[model samples]
Target chain A: MSSLSRTTFASLIFGFSFLYLPLIFTAIFAFSDAELAGVWTHFSLKWFKAILNDEDLLIATFTSIRIAGISATVSIILGTLAAAATMNTPRGKYDGYNFLKRIILLPIMIPEIITGFSILMLFMVIESMFGWPKERGILVVAAGHSVASVAYVYATVSSSLASLDQSMGESAINLGAKPIHVFFHITVPLSWRAIVSGWFLAFILSFDDLVIASFLTGPGTSTLPIVIFSNIRVGVTPTINAFVTVFVVITIILASIVYFRTLCLKGRRKGRSATR
Target chain B: MSKKVVGFFLFITLLIVILQWKVKDDYSGEVVNVYGWYGIIPREIFNDFEKETGIKVRYDFYDNNEMLEAKLLSTNNGYDIVFPSFIPYASRQLLMGIYSKLNRKLIPNIKNIDGIITSKFGANGGDVQFLVPLFWGTIGIAYNKKVVSQLLPGETIDSYDVLFDLSKISKLFPYGVSFPEEYIDILPQTRKFLQLKHGGESVTDFQECFRFLEKVRPYITKFSSTTMISDLLSGDVCIAIGASDNAYRAMRSSKAVDKDIQYTLPKKTGILWIDCLGVPKKAPNKRNAYLLINYLLSPEVAAKITNHSGILVNLPAALPLINAEIVTKKDICQSDPEVLEGLTMGCARAENTRELIKAWSQYKTNTHHTSINKEASK
Candidate 1:
């Protein structure tokens, strides 16, 4: 191989290993039989079995998943609409539109601790005034996560939407397609990849969030990260590693399926183009 | 594709609806929400409480006292019960009126609390009407026997001298000597060691502690509280000034790794740390909170907690029921009245806390090595 190709190959290996070595070690140690989490002993599935009986961990994991799902979906919907509204507006037509765009990005720019504290204050004010959300719980946590995640989704979707040929939607509208149909069929279809990536980004953000969730969490609303963090002072059990390994395996399986599905879709598109 | 996306979203909505339904189901019965340190209470105890009283226990956890204090200080925090450390947090929060007065009539089992722990907490301005001193531990020296013996042969690892003494700590510097992260944990012991007046509110008392800490700062390898247990077990630190429960855990785990780990309260000065169980002023289910507290104070449950977690529950009756290994461990479950009597509870004064923190940070970041260099010049 040429030196350029050799350098490229070396960098690729370096990058991938750097990203994955810690995960690989965590996976390996999950199966160790030792009492100490870091120690390596003979391979055992006891920790996995231990997870089966840990009701609190299971509940926390379920709560985390539910919050992530709700937040990701809500953020994606709100974000896509925000992106469309902001991007479709004529430049300098509305001064408030520019301010609105900046306001939407504020959650991303500001520190999370400040955001968490302010959201907590907001909840307390709302509780005192309206007394509707009488107690903070899953709904409050999900709402906080959604507020934080919407900025990320907006950033991802708008950048992809900006690169799109606007003329395609305009032409479709001219060809007897209504504006709603044009948006759904043309704009959304073109930008769905960015939307999917954005959803994943939002999902991960909500899933691993500790600061905001801690502030908003009430009785029986502890998320997985909160539960794991609370266990850190007392060293975390190997069951957590076992749980992570299970999570990693599931994520890998889902990713490969998505990867193969996209590959197949690309192959089908190429064949259709060649036939045409 | 739109249909698939719609289907996925519908599935997520359905899952959320089901989860919300499940969460709502919990409130149908009498419920008490408890927030405390993680891994301290065994799950079996909660289950038993529920079975006996038919009041479900919804337990949450915070790793540190600051988080608990923040939640408590907030209006309508919705926690029926919370465990805050006695000194500084519980005492400070008590003064803030975040905790409600306990209905002693509801909790008849309050008599079971060990007197020694109670008096120590009371002396430190902890009030039984507001806070129940349920869990207690000591701050002391945890050292790896093999490493320490090799480094300083024939040296007894009992006192804070293993940590604060310049000559002794300098010897253990290469093997690693870690101090406590919190100023409250080490400063009181430092005061006791230096024979400074405990009640002296002067900034000079803090200055004296820092002056001593500054001399030995370079020899100290790291300042951490949470990582002490693992650091000892992994041989990362041969000596650490930390909580007794963490040291006990390290000692227990060390046996498996073929390493001897020991914890000792200094003969001259041992600091007692207490976690107070209190009901929030705005608790939603105060009645159920009382029931849960009464249940936990029972000997069987309290013993189970100590046996499982190695944290000493402040119930003297539970001592006999605890594991023989833990009950026998002098440094951990201190049965001796003399040792318990000598223990000083450390509390940071509210007005001088900022000054103490400033001095602590200054000592932590001071890297000039002025004392050592001056000695070398001499």
Candidate 2:
């Protein structure tokens, strides 16, 4: 076992501190009793209690989560299908397949503001023409988020799918299995990890989105970021800090659960192999 | 593996369906959608309105006027009611035909609106028939009393001189002086101050305002609008040019931190800022919007809003019902008739907006003269 050099050690410390110091301070201040976020007084749970009473903030949080969940699900389906279609097709066999690959990645290339604005314009045009979607709301926001995140899901899923051995799927096809059967049994199961990771990525992207959500959100559909951003005009209350602290704690707990579950699964696999 | 995957997806599908159902359940009833500034109106008022009329209020908020304008400009924004500031946003939006002609009959309580604010708004080309100028406040000087007193002994901090006067502001510069982020906040006040000082001839030129600002620009420690309250409370800035409502908030919070924060309407030239309420032209629930607006207009409701939010609502009848703390605080709610009369409402003409924005950005980023001289010499 080799130790890290002094330069590497110092750089690693600097990098971690740079990334985490603000979050650490935010979590610290979340417990402060002072009205001003920057000031530190005594520790208090008043802000945590205040969050429960803040019906608007709670509603916004749920709205954000719902939108993220719906969009992540939609994007995962769309992205997986797009990835399979593009990856399974033999190179240069279809002219449009190459074009499709390039076009699928366009959303990732374009800036989010432009994507939000253009999608908004498209919705307006559709409304004027077809008179459908009568109003922008949660659905419109979810659709907009899916459009922005599907490219990311596609990127993640495709890169992982590309690394898989193509012979497995070919052999399944050779053994008289249908394309659907092969996709479900072989392609999907093998790339399940990538699909799950992609779904999480899309979920986070949609959850953290402010620009696209702002453009598409309508009456009674303000997302969490929109709600928090609006509080800036009047100084942001410490309740938001408490809210964020709670969110961080939940994330850490969830992450640890996943870590231990993976560890347990790995240990079980080792035990099965050893017994065999 | 496939069965587990299928179950996972089914669970997610069920969760989404339940969420969608929950979100849509509230829309089954009659509702009025309001878009306004966050924390301006208390929740109890909305609850009271709901209990009285059985019409639920779906309130959404935006921190800035631009966000509200963006929605209004878009097709079918679905907002039954919106609050836009009078000077630039509501005034400009009115010209774009975004607002519907409010039915005066629906809002009979409109008569309770203060005459002074209405007239002041009207002078700035605000039409009550379209945009109802309801929420109002002043843009003034908010300073740390202890810091300012120590910075300039024997000096009263009642006027803009403490900020605009280069000599006086220079002394406070070390302690830290903050300026408004928006050009509109300070430009009009600067114009008024110059007009009062120079007999209103040479100062009429906007260029003179910029030149005057240039002298004090070097001394400004930071340019901010939203964080002024915390800045004042934290002693980050000894003095800041900010909105009266924010100043009131700072003053209220300052006590908890053991700081003496005071806000003053510039004695010579105070700027009146008004937020107007109106229904978008294509509002889906115009009737409910009218009902909500009228409910808000009632003196008791308006007074409750003012009391809870520190934002002054323009209802003369609500005056007596307002808290003494807000009413007594002359800077927050100026009850003095003479001073109130002198409060000028400033609006940039539609054509001048582009030029004003350009000038403001230039002023914000302009380098110090000495630095410029050094660069030129180099």
Candidate 3:
């Protein structure tokens, strides 16, 4: 590698370390068996044991997973529909479509505090007006996460659609396949990668959130992030470290799965096309 | 092209329909939403009051007081009641200022508050209207006597300085020590160690306090040990600097079981802390809020929490309700005025507050890794 390339590589390594060092430190302490708190000593599975045994933590994690799953699926559907609708529109309507797209992206692009606050206000207003179940806060949070995720899905899928051969759709119709059948057989399957990417984004955003969760959350509705956030002042204990390390490991594993799956799908698509 | 415009019109119409249907559901007023810090008592106290009063209460709590403040400034938050530490409440001009007066006229139970606190801030702030005294206490060392005496045979365990002596520390203790992580309180802790004044809101005596903490750095194993009090009673730790009320609770439970635990107001003084409750200026249910405040301050209610939580109460009259063992301890109420002042000054050292935090942060950053090693080596 050239000297400049070596320097750039070093910079990337430094950047990754800078962002992730604290998390690594936290992981180390999670396994710490030190008598007095502070420095890491000999490693132990004590904290990990405490976390695995916590029924509340497990339940909270389950709730978060269910919420994330529902949100990701919903976001993918909404995003794909919006993208398809916008892509086929006339040149005169492009300005209006872009405006609407910007609105969809607003929730994620703006500060999280602002987005969370506005949604919370909307919920409070609705609660007062309609006397809805107070657990509506969960629905609101899911909606917020999905709305943010939709923009990412739409952007990715719209670009994918732009790259797709439109002649396939025309030929399918000419061959007596109805529009709906063509969509089901061709459009959706082709957009699966974008849909899955959207799902991943939506799920991660909902799970990692703290600020938005804190604002919209009510009694008995605390997600895992809120639970962990509240316990910071209680001081870092083995149980906390164990809980976090497990959470981190699980996220890393799932992210890798998503990454490898995308690569595999892209490879299969390329192989099929090349053979044809 | 006209067909495309027509389709766009249809889409906009659908969006409008959905928005309108949603907007139609919003109401003007139905609940008095209360956002406050949630914990042992603040979590449960509202339930009783909500039941007694017909005004429906919607309450939520954040762990940190700053989170509460942030919510108040944001439009999404519409809290009728906000409970914040008096210091932060005083500092912020917009979110607070209503607390400048105790207005016993509104809350009749104010008559029973501990004179030390209510008189200091209740209608008594220096032209700054910010908070009512909800609760107050000093920071001190809580210890298991057997472990402590064994650790320090000839040397007396009386000052904050003792925490710096590796020779005196207990090997039995798992967590060497713990303190709050708040930036505001960190500085004062250092200055008070050096007999310095806060000077004013900005902090004056921090340098001296910082120097002292830096001096004591290696001796401290960890400061992120808020749960150390619980550990101390379990004998995982011999001693820790903690809230008086936390110590009292540990001792009360331990003594009943025939276990010996002691909490001390160090000879050099400890930190004093206060937690208070107040209704916002634009509270949705102001009358009901006053009623709730009055109800909590009622002698019976106040006494129940004080005894249960073991924290010092704001109402001096409620002092009688404090766990009998803690109030009756002779060592805590020293014969010497100097020692008593030192203990009282523990939380009140406004002088060196800033210096304390700098020292703590520096220590936390520098010696951050060695805490567990020290324990393991021992």
Candidate 4:
């Protein structure tokens, strides 16, 4: 039994090391002085300085942030509403609820490149008909990103809704509360954490997207992932390593804050229960 | 919390509207949208162009020719200037009626362009009105001399057999060969190498190219478009068939890290490629596009582009301004016309391209399975 346990432990370590070793190497190389990527001659911070001064990269980063924020927000609102609609409607009352759910989740099923190209075609048709969107710019990119993100948000929020007690909303409605009020006061509050998590997930998906972003990107609207991808294609420069490092740092900070806040909330809930 | 979230959403909506308005206004300015290969042009040139012409240059990049073609065909691509390789795609684009004629009157600097460039394009149905030559280079074998020297003492590295003669070189360094992943770049070289070996066939022969490609498929450890230079520098692959400019750049970069790498033009034949700048049809900023082109053509700007890109430029006036060391490097500066002796320039192969690409794909798939089987047996 001891031997089996030790072997399993060793395999676990091997698996995780295989997964994270590249990321560790990337972080280490971000500070390496070498240009051609093999041996570290000396430690340096010049790559970070180079990243800060790269106007195009900075602009791309800003564009990505803007698109991710807007797309995530749009996903949250639309996903929450869709989840509410499905949860409220009776199976027989809405004859096509399952079909609607599948349609809503279709973006997740379809390959991203196909979705990107299709969205591009859709936007082009809409532009031809209405002449509203003068060009394929940020709004179009945001819409393209939101298409993929909505499914993610919907999946998370709907799962949370499915797990919730059915009688809560019913009891609220029976206690002389309006249906809309019950939805706002009960359904939303209970599912708020899931919605927030879904929003963050959508944000990351839109942020990290390269294929869809490439198709939807137009003049002056190149995103971070697209720029990094093209630059890395030629060669892996130290500046790209620095960019990845910064991205990793940001992700870590965000994750830590969320983790600590959740811990605190849980602790507070425990204390309230103890008092009761 | 809900109210705060709503307010934040409203604020973001307002910000997006403002940004969109600004983007629309940017088009009215003297902005030239230049699409070209990534890392080909230095950023300083764009800054200098903006300073001189007051035309803001927004540069975008693509790795392959197909992407550029797709962009040109798409509605409202908004690119004013596109730098596509002169052969095949440019000519194909011309046939498609997607490109606009250059206003030679606006570009008085056209006179500064070398006659060799203009005449070559003119002979090949590339009118000066349609394309302005940007940079030109050749595709050849890039090798590590230290490794190749031990394999064959006193033998010159000028021939493609340094890569193709697998039994001789592969035993010396197993899996020491790498070819390009792109069919377009590798196919031309394959045709030329096989022609040199098998003695003169049509440049468009699918069976011949595939024969050589399949013969070499097992010897090559990887088909790399992106990581070829790195592999060569690391002494992983002794020989790589790549562009002269890329090979030269890798050699220069390796010097900084104390790695020995060198590039050699094939002794008998090589594929010559020239990338040209042109304005696409219905370009919103044609006037600024012309200004930017003429600016790029100017001797000083052209010299800087040549120096930084490590590729030869066609502006005769820029020649005097180019660094003496750079001009002497045969790979970058093949100014003499005599050097064009056995070089085959890529032309519009629209007829054979589809079939050749298909055959190559099938060959590659077969080779991939064989390689997998060999690995499994090992």
Best-fitting candidate, scored by lDDT: 2
Clashing pairs in 4: none
Residue pairs in candidate 2 whose N, alpha carbon or C atoms collide under 3 angstroms: none
lDDT against the true structure, per candidate, is: 0.85, 0.87, 0.60, 0.77
TM-score, B chain, candidate 1? Answer: 0.94
The TM-scores that each candidate's chain B achieves against the reference are: 0.94, 0.93, 0.72, 0.88
Query: What would the per-residue lDDT of candidate 4 be over residues A163-192, giving only the tens digit for each residue?
Result: 888888878778899978877877787787
- Candidate 4 lDDT by residue in tens digits, B245-279: 77867776787567788787775667677888889
- Native A-B interface contacts kept, per candidate: 0.51, 0.78, 0.13, 0.35
Specify the highest-DockQ model's number: 2
The candidate scoring highest on TM-score is 2
* Residue B161, candidate 1: alpha-carbon lDDT: 69
Per-prediction tally of clashes: 0, 0, 33, 0
Ranking by lDDT: 2, 1, 4, 3
Runs off by more than 4 Å, candidate 2:
A5-7, A91-96, B196-204, B367-378
- Residues B1-378, model 1: lDDT tens digits: 777656655775786687678768866878899998888898888998888888888888788988888888888888999989888788888888888899989999998985888988888788988889999999988898898999889988777767776777888999888989888898888888999875785766666667677788888888999888878877788999999999888887786677899888886688899988999989999999998999889999889999989999999898889998887788877768888888877755798777667667666777453333333446
Q: Give the alpha carbon lDDT tens digit for every residue of A87-155 in model 3.
A: 645457568887886776665578888877777777777776875534444456677667666777787
Q: Which stretches of candidate 1 lie over 4 Å from their true place?
A: A1-4, A90-99, A171-178, A271-276, B367-378
| Model 3 chain B weakest 10-residue run by lDDT | B122-131
For residues A1-276, write the lDDT of model 2, one tens digit per residue.
Answer: 159888998899999999989888888888889887877878998999999988889988988998999999999999999999889766678999878988999999999999999999999999999997887888899999999999999999999889988888888889999988988888788788898899999999999999999899898889999999998888978898999999999999999999999999999999999999
Better of 2 and 4 by lDDT: 2
